[model samples]
Target: MKSRSPLVNRITIVVCAVVLTSIVSMATTLAVSKSIEGNATAINLAGALRMGAFRLLAQAAGPGDNHNTAEPNISSFLDKYEASLFDRLITRAIPRTADHPLTNQYRAITSYWETTLRPGLENHPQGSPVSVEMHANTETYVDSVNQLVSMLERRTEARIGLLHLIQIISLAFSILIIVALFVDLRNRVLKPLRKLVSIAGAVGEQDFSQKANMTGSDELAQLGSAFDQMSSELALTYYELEERARSKTEELEKSHAALQLLHTASRNLFANHDLCSGAVPMLQELEELLGIGPIRLYLHDKEAAEPVEVVTTASTDRPFYCRDHHCNACLVSPEDYDELPIEDNDGRRLLLPIRTPGKLLGTLEVWYPAETGLSDTARRLLEILSDQLATAIFLERQITEEQQLTLAEERTVIARELHDSLAQSLSYLKMQVARLRRLNIEGDQKSAHESILEELSTGLNSAYRQLRELLATFRLKLDTPDLATAMRKTIEEFSTRLGKPVGLNYNLPPQALSPNEEIHTLQIIREGLANAVKHADATEVIVEILFESPQVKAKIRDNGKGLPVGEQPVNHYGLVIMQDRARTLGGQIVVKNRDSGGVEVILTFVPKSRHLIPTEAPST
Candidate 1:
């Protein structure tokens, strides 16, 4: 459809109106000017005729003897006046209605000139009486001409006022038309443009609801339509972008939450040394973090032939017990299993196998709502948590085994001590008592019997003393797991018992020994202290434990009478035991008589591995 532009149409109408007003104004002005010109012309013609009649009269009355010439001049002036009057009357330059007397006077003048004055002038000479009468008529004619001229001047002034009035009306009309045009333009163009500008600003501010509702077929209307379309599209795109941003933000939050969950689970697992107790909090954390329910943990029990339920965040009604590894999800390795939640008879469940580098320890199982199963982040977090759990379990088991082994070794040491020292003494005592009884049965003499009884009593006392020492050795316990603390306690105990100040110089890092190593080391120190107190007759004792690169050296020295002269060191059971302990520690023991006075027992050993010293102390 070819629609006319409203702006163009409005402008065209305005132009036409202005042009029409201008034409009317021009025509009125021209008409006024023509009227004025005609009035002026008529006034001049009347004046000229009046002047000519006066001149003619003057020439006739001048006393000149040329009356024929004056008569000719009067005839010529009469003819000129008649022609001017005819022209003025014919052209109607002077309105007959308002100027009726003037017109009548002009007509009478012309009649008198043609009929009376002209004939008289033509017949008589200029000096005659008829000429004098003509001169009087000329003066009346001049007065009428002046009245006509004043009338014409008044008419011209009236025409000029009418022209001005018309021009004022035209100008007012033109101004009205122009004001209308301006209003039309303002309504049609400027107003809509301002509205469009406002809408554009609103769009820039991301407020797309505002619209340019201009209702016309003008260019501005088209622009508004295009703007509306653009706003709609921009709003749609903005909504899409907002949705995408929201989704991304949600995803990022989820990822951060998952990472936090993983971090917390890892910290819990590694923080607590007790696997069974530690796993509970980690499982609870996982449950809360993942928004799942009834999280359960299982540990493999080789003896039971089934995985044992170790910890649970919820009730134990839904235990995941798999003995034969029949459940695919439970037995699958972390790498082999896909991280998707599995659907079984008991709702959706995610199974993550807790594993270490050596073996799979168990499975961490969580039951979730079917509609909102596990997300990938949760699954991955569970996987990481499972690995940490497995590591914790492994460490706990290894520590337990080490403790058990240490206990067994202690038992062995006790058994060896009993066998080596107390057993021999008891056996000797039993032999002596039996001999004394036999001697008594034979009715030996009193002196011999008393002597044998004395020997048996001495052997029994030695046996009792050895048994007491064995008991004390077995009763020794480390106050703390660190070797240095235990050794200090031992030194303090011995010093108090011996009623002598026992000096100790300890300079080894804590946890420098395995449990078993610490047990052996403590036992050797105990025996050395006992030997020093009982046999060395030492007044002061100094115990020193020092570490050199890859080797630990311990020494017990006393200010006592040196070992008996010519005594073999290996002959002493206590020295032998210390040597055995040192050998067991992959080291050697030296018992030397110090030049000062006392005997010094020194042991030096290199650990099997430098890495045996734990970076962190073991929790009790």
Candidate 2:
């Protein structure tokens, strides 16, 4: 499915709002119906209690009793005891009609009780002789009331069922509408918007020739119109901006060119493969640029080692030397060397510290022969250039450190592989050779003995070749197709040691891997397969290699009991070693379980370094 555009997203939000409103409105209706049902149930329960009370009274009385009452006594008695009696009756039989369905039937029963039974109960006292007729008369009314209550319950259930059906239908319809809307918006709008966006992006890259032909006058059309207009205006403004920009750009370019020269000159000062050869040329350039009569560079040291005087020039006009006390400031803090009368004869001198990251690398001092002095820009620029030199020095140190790390990791891997596979095999061969030698020494010249000796010789040669090849694994100075071959042989040895069969399945074309990517791929594959064989308990493993331009993929799969959820293999040293190695190669690892069984581990490495490849070439 295509992603929704901003306009489609807005439409979706609006539709969602309408759907939510409908849902809330339905909820309100259901809530109101429930409230009304509660009230009706309460009324029904109250009526049931009143009617039940009257029926009980009538049952206690005999037939032929006068159950009717006169107006005054009934009215007065009702006013006093009707409410209290009703409460007592309900509190005993049915306290509330809430959640009960026979509400209407109970209401009718209560109405009949108020008009007929309550009046009689008020007018006649207990133990009245007129009770028999009252009992007979109310018996028929009781049967009718029971039937009515049953009907009311059935009707209540039906109504509730209907409401539930409406709710389900409402939800189903709303969901269907949303799904259809999304499909329509995706195909009709989102896909087209994406095409327009791509064209717009190209236009932004200053390809003003690119245009979007919006066929219809929809919102998308307006967007295309706005985009086209922007491109046209951008083209017109490009020339004006370019002219003004060129002036400023020229200034910027000039500044950049000057900075480049400064960087190059400063780099030459310390960029010695050997410091001894580069030092003199640095001082010569400095003297020529600054017009100083005499210059000297002193390297700062925390411990006393005779400071190497890198460069020195004799003053033609006057001799200037660092007084004994001035050397103290230069040694401890070159930044505070301003206290010294470092000025030249005409009051123009310059002192700069080549410092990086706290420690001082060195200091440069120039003695002017005339009144002219270095400007502020020149001073600031000199300090900046000094910093660049210091950084370069630091970088050179790091390159050495990194090379050592790479060599060390390579050595470790080679040593471990040899120790685990080739060494053990060689030891077995030695044991066989020793046994054959003992047999020959004993003078057992039987046919079997001769055959064994010949076999041992062949085995020794094979072991020799294998050991030499195993040692060659460490000699990988650059990533190549040969590295892949070495890695495959290593995996075979690993599988043999583990008593499992492993196969290498690849379709990598020739010259498909970069030097760095090739090394990273070898390492990741080595580690991944080793992990799977050791931990996954698989019988057979298949390794797949696919090379697509700009990306190369390697995957290892085994048909073993899959890894447990959230489980990772234990790495005693640290699991991060593999992860870090991958990151260094600008790659990542993904491990997952196949649906059938076992584990799958994949690694992808891409070159992100500009220094490693030609800039104009597309990624391979």
Candidate 3:
């Protein structure tokens, strides 16, 4: 295995390069500056030496008679010049060689001072002629020293130019190094980091297809590898979770479909009051839901002592026979047949017992292919269907019985009404005819004969009126479900039959009366209207039905001659019947003459059954 340099090392290298370059640049600058400073010192020393030599020469060349006075000044100038020259040579560290131009000049000047000028100046007195030679030599030495100073100045200028060049080069190199570092950082660190950021953002959005294709022996590469692993694991986990959710959803859908099928079948079975009308559709629904067809339903006819096939899906010529034991098997122990389907030649049959709480109504037989047996779910659904069918059948039978009982009760009422009104009236007429025949044979008084005839006529008229009232009561029909509409019809019938205006002010709440209450109320109103038309001979009649909580009131008023001023007609059969109806409704009826000069019949009742009270008023 091979190891590469880490990011830190690479960065360190770049920093070190910058620092090293800076150090080198500074060193070069210091070297150049020191060299220029040394050259400046040399130039200054040389100039001083030249100035001292000129002074010595000038003093030496003074008037010959003043040579004694100028001697000390010339000696002082020589000493100063020697000191400046020695200082320049020592400071410059230049050898006395002729290899370099400035060095050779300096060495020549030093040799001239040491070997000739110094020897002459020291050997000859200041006032002697030898001093003249000394002045000339000093002037030449000053000129040479000036020439050396010029050369040193030129050298210092060249060194300054070299320093400027080095500084410029160093600056350019530093800039290039910085640019390289920036480019390297962008390529190696910033770009890859940006890619990682983008990848992370993609991962957050649940898109895992993209990968960090970063390549290096760096930490970012290792991080990318870890990220890829995490993404792969997360994707795999998500796939597994999705598959589980899909499977669970499928299971839930299946359960819901079964429940819906059962619910629909139950609704269809109970929706129809007559089970025979709904049984075919229910069987078809069951066949569809169970994925099997050819269903037959057999209901036991206890009166006929046989099983009747009420509904069947299959068209077969062969009749289905129910044996004694088969009916008993369903009725006695339903659980025995719940485990498995019964095998048959055409297919398998599942015999489910249709039973109510205590009675076995019938058996439901479902036929399926032999290869496909009944599933537990199918069996369970079949049991539920059978239960619903049993319930529907039970309700149907109960409703049929109730209808028959209501018809019987109505017949008994009609018989009683005939016996009470028509039978008694006819018996009276027969007796009157017998008496009239006897009186005619005996040849009685004319007044007595007229009275008998008049009585007969009145009796005949009253009997005819009672008969008409009975016919009207029997003819009354409810065209709509609303009690208000029924009341209006009753009022209209009376108005039309009596040839009198009948007005109905109906303000009762809908559904406030049960079927029994409605019937009794209608009859009572009919009786009241009949009395108004027959006895009152009213010109106008008004019927009012008012509803209050827990009680209903009906009022009938006629604008006719008030009741006779005598005992009430308590024994009148019509009035007695009206009172009976009111008693049956747990209420009472009152008949009185209005104070304003008419007859008024009022009936008030608290409904017998609270459960039968309707929530809203009947629609007219």
Candidate 4:
């Protein structure tokens, strides 16, 4: 947690070591270089001294006039030579030992130059030819100068070698320091950093158990400690979250299973005949779902407003829920939702209302041991089961009521059919008989009586035919409950009987129309087919039932001679009966002659999804 960085200090130390090594190398080099600084100049001056000796020799050998031009040149050159010999570059390069080779040679050269060469050049006669002795002295001086130049070069070369040695040592020291710094960084920083990187990678992969585990008080150690703490915290938090998630997962799984079981129960309830038939198995499933005790179901008639039936689990040998007179259901209306807090020698009893929207139809009573208590989950499940039970019972009752209403409506239609066709024929026959009786009484019972009798016979036969048609129409209900199946069979039968191709184009969804709508629609098609069979005298027939949303349309076409223009079929009430059925279904039918020489019977109606209940808003 400190803001201290040891790496900075370590780098500072390394830099200082390198800089110090460089400074020492430079100082050593500077000393050695100072020792050899002017050796090159000294070597050049020594060579020049040798050349001056040659000039002095040449001057001594020349004629008197040549000496006149060269006397001042030799004197000036000798004077400069003396001054340069004792200058800093030459004199300051003195060796420590008095007998050192370079120093001795330097002194010899200086003495020779001052003692022999200078005097020879200065004191010689002007313009005199140089003697052989003077030339020999000059040669000796040139030799000394060459030896001095060689010694100066050797001395300068030695100092240069020392300077190189210092530089080499400085480079080695710097290299050593840099290598040490790298090793230190590897041990102190780089290794730890690599470990931290690996740990960070592990953490990214949800492996929070990995730790940097670095020791010491360096920056990396502190970073590692902080990282480890973070990892620990993350581990704890993740573990807690995992526990909670696991628990929640268990709850969700249980809820899913319960919902699946409840769904299966509901499917069995509705898929079977009625609630009473499947009630025992449903109650047992509810018991298994809740882990509770025996359950009972009571049925109530909303119309009669009394408890009508009781169905319970087969587990109990006796009447567990109630005795006939001890039942508390009398205290509550069939539509009441109040709880029946009935407890008996059996145990605690819980009652769930089996109800639909705005109506209570029955109750599901569960009796459990007194020690066993229901959880909120189980109680909620029971409520849902009760709702499903209510829905199934309510739907079944609705189907029964619809079938009864349909039956009554059809019976009324049949009565109207009898009145319109068969009853009219019977009345006509009665009149004919009365006329026949009058003829017999008047003793004119010859051809007139026979005609009246023939008329009566025709009326009776017509009545009998109408009666048969009515029986056939009624028999359709017992034969095939499904309208499509009945229509298919009818089409096949008519094709077989008429010896003509009969096509059925049924395009309606099965659930689009109610049972009543289907019945009326199928019967209208049958009536059209019947009329065609009796009188159409045609070749082909086509029956089509189609649905456009909110509407069902049926068409029965026969390639048969249509009815006489504006006239009904004689002694037949098919059209009247079809009109009655269509009216009952809140639809219309048209029976007319096709333009292509046939009868076309088309009926269209809005199908009822429910029993014509007047709702405030239409359900989508």
Candidate 5:
């Protein structure tokens, strides 16, 4: 909670200041003491030299010469001489022994007296050149005093100069220390702290989007780490909440779509319509609603000795049978219903039984991988879909039976009309022609004539048109053709009608296209040509058909003025009709503009029987 930086800084400053002050005080005191000692030493040396020279001159001049004043002069000179000698020795030796500034001055004065005064006094009688010698000593003393004073002044100046230099150095060092302290605070502590504060402020504002670039393994880095932890936690929490909300929304959507499909399927099945046609649509809606990969159907046989023995499938050409004779469901009872995993090179398979109150249909087998196994909810939905599909199948069988009865009645009526109209007319015409020939033989042309000829021609044209219509109907009623040839024929018809350069190319192996595929291909080709004529101003057309092992394909190309892809025209029912036909046959239609200034319509045909392998009938 408490920081030590400020306190540490304050103590450092105080210590530095105290050390600098002490150094300055010591330097100044030493300088002043040296200056005072130099000045005092110069003055004392000059005074001692003066006294010794005066006393020595008096001593040499007295003693029985100038008899009356001799004794008194001699006594006074001797006393002065003794006192000067004492003063001279003490000033010179004592100062030198003490090692004071006066020692140098005393030695200089002693040399001056000995060189000029002492030699002159010893060379002549005591009183012989006393005044000259005394004058010389006095001059020498004055010169020596001037020189000593100058030396003392120079010494004092040097000491003061040293003191000034020391003070300057101390002040400079103190200022440098203070500047360094300020710089350290700015670079190391204060700047980093400010950076941390800015980063924290940004984070507090919910801006975990940006990060701090703090470096080093310092305390600031630790703070940066803490900030990172908080930011990461907040970001993770927000992401988790967002994901949960999204998941719930998606689940709700799926549930609503599933319920809607159930409602629609129920309505369609109960209606008195073609249930076979409706069942496919219902299954497709269910597939889209529940995101089913693929779907199939297996039905129980009502006309067989046993339902399982003669099971049927929604696939027109396929008969249903159990997966090997001894499959896991072979002896499975209703209460013991379970799923068995079947693995093959293609993928995994799941075999589920279709059961009602007291009857069992052929098992509904699905092929999917292990990872994408049916969930319980999905299985339940499938169960519902399967039940609904069975009811629809039952209704469709009923519709088929009724349609068969109605078709038989219509055939009988058409046969009757053919017999009544054409046969009776032919019979009457024969008799009339027979009588006309007899008249011609007898030369009677007035009663016979153009009436018979015109009537015959009219009836013949009518008969021809009726025959063409009948042939068209019969072609439609016959079994579905081989898809490859059917597609080619349709394309050729379109080319003739359009009077354009058109061609059909098929890519299938011989006899590979199945019955359902043949019909679908025919429908697709017919629709594609109709589309080309209406939408594409095509001059050259090409129809390509391919029947591979797994799927059938028809690609129609035309060099024409291309239309915008996927932009369905408002009144364009032709393309919609094509798409509807494809959907009915469980196929897809894709239209796009080809590179060579043309439109290409692709029809992909997946035969329902490919996924539904037929079961061989049992040997009687």
Candidate 6:
């Protein structure tokens, strides 16, 4: 890295170089002027004096008449001689200074002019004829004048040579300065700027790896460093973005896979109500999906409080167990459930909670024997799977309870029908038989016999009607999937049956229901809805069902005439049936006229599982 000048300094150097060159040239001109200052003027004056001397000599030789008319003559030799001697040019040429070489000669000439030459010229030079003495004096004066002119001419020629030499040196200096400035401009400014431009072009082409060679103290050098830094940072950012994008793509793939698993899991869970039958296979898939070691699920079926179940994907022996083997304490104890992820056995295992909003259904314990704990994507998938498993367990329990409830409801219907129809008919027939037994061969025998026949006919018809109704009730199976879907179907059915629209508001979480709560709820809602449609003559009917954690509430409202005044709802078979269903659910039903021109049927029940759904800690 060679040293370099700053831009300001470099510019200053070039300016100074040019300025110095100009000063040198100006100084050279001044030196030349000083060297030959008066030489040229003095030479001209000397030459004029010499020519006057020759002209005076010529005039003395006789241009007095005819020849003098052709050439000009020095008619007054003294006047001409004095004027040339006293002229500024002649004075300047001959010096009287002590250091001057011409001082004596100049003084001698002054003496000659004042004393000898002036006297001689004044006496005879006024149109005088030529003489030997005059001629000799003129020639001597002319010889002196020639000597002075020759010396002046010689000194002026020397000065001219000096001027030429000075000019040559100044020109060389100026050329050298300009060439130096040009080289400096190229090195300091142009080359570095080109480097920066090249780096910029590389970066514009998305080649972030290019860097400028930074090696000076100049502005261009600093700019090159800046370009290098910019490229470096861009390269880093580009790689970072690539890494992030790669990780994001991998995460998306994991999410897609997790979604596929959840979809299939939900489908299978819904298709089969027996939980453990699918649980083992699902746990196996989950273990493989996560690439973790074997996994186990601990379930607490609140219904069968005595026994806890642990389902495992791998058939390996259980490494650990609780002290209470029969009760399976580890599966049920609150301490065994971990809501937050925890690493065990040197961070190779995790225990996650299987929970819904209403209850803590189970615990999922997983391990990775060959590696550390699961990655974030794996953990998120596991959490989602835990939720699915919780719901699956809930659905399994609800299905079981629903099946039992349906059987029990059928039995209760049978008992109620038998009590309402067959028992009464049999009782009436027994009464008729007793009357027959008690009667003797009396006058009213025909009347007694006709009465007995009528009783028998009446009892048989009653039995037949009850049988038809019981058959109708038992012959149909529920067509819809879940309770909400069933309720929606029921409402739609009533809407069509009543020839108008029926509004339904149903909100129920998929959860386990009490012994007969599901069937009872559905039956009670149906009964209330039917009454609102057929009996109330409703123009609008709204059926609303909401299930809180432990309680189910339903309402059937109609914007129409309510029950007839002073009518007792207890007497109606539909109302009686609703009441019976509500009672079976451990709930109460109410039928009343609304102040707003309608009748509202309300039912509220705390289904048995409502007790099982852990109360929200008085906080939730």
Instruction: For each candidate, give its TM-score against the true structure.
Output: 0.45, 0.26, 0.40, 0.38, 0.36, 0.49
Residue-by-residue lDDT tens digits, candidate 1, 1-620: 98678767778888998999999999989978876776766777766766766666665555544445544555565576567667844346755564576556556666666776556555556555544566666666667667767766777788989998999999899889988878887888788889889999999899999988667777888898999999999999999999989966875676687677667666766776534445555565556556665667787644334565656654312222211112122233444223333344335877888888878878888777687666776677677777777777778667755784677667768867787876787777777677767654446477787786777676576556656666676766654435755666787889888998899877654334666787788888888898888887888999888765447788999988878777664324667778889999999999888988899999888765332221221121
Choose 1 or 2, whichever is better by TM-score: 1
Write model 6 residue lDDT over 287-375, tens digit each, in one string: 55656645777765433332234465553222121111232211322343232123443436677888888788778887764344567
Candidate 3 C-alpha lDDT tens digits along 1-70: 8665577778888889889989999999998887676676677777877777666555555544544664
**Residue 340 lDDT (model 4):** 26
Clashing pairs in 1: 67-126
Reference-based lDDT, each prediction: 0.69, 0.57, 0.70, 0.70, 0.57, 0.66
TM-score of 4: 0.38
Q: Over the full model, what C-alpha lDDT does candidate 3 score relative to the true structure? A: 0.70
Worst 10 residues of 4 by lDDT: 611-620
Better of 2 and 5 by lDDT: 2
Per-candidate count of clashing residue pairs (backbone under 3 Å): 1, 10, 6, 3, 1, 0
* Backbone clashes, candidate 5: 1
Residues 1-620 of candidate 5: C-alpha lDDT, one tens digit per residue: 97655436555775767586666667676756644553455445545545555555656654436656535544464455435534643443233454655456656655665675556545446565467646666567756756655655565566667777777776777777678767866765687778778767876786666555656555656666676676778778877888878865765676677767877777877783433344456655655555443344555543334333222222323223322222222233433222322243233555566655576645555544466555555567667766765665556545554554555466557656766776577667656655655654324654456466556655654454444333332243212123443454565667777887578665443223344445445656766776676568888888777543346667888888887756665434556657887898787999888888888988876566433222443321
> Residues 131-154, candidate 2, lDDT per residue (tens digit)?
665665466456645555455455
Which regions of candidate 1 fall more than 4 Å away from where they truly are? 1-431, 434-467, 565-571, 612-620
The predicted structure with the larger lDDT, 4 or 6, is 4
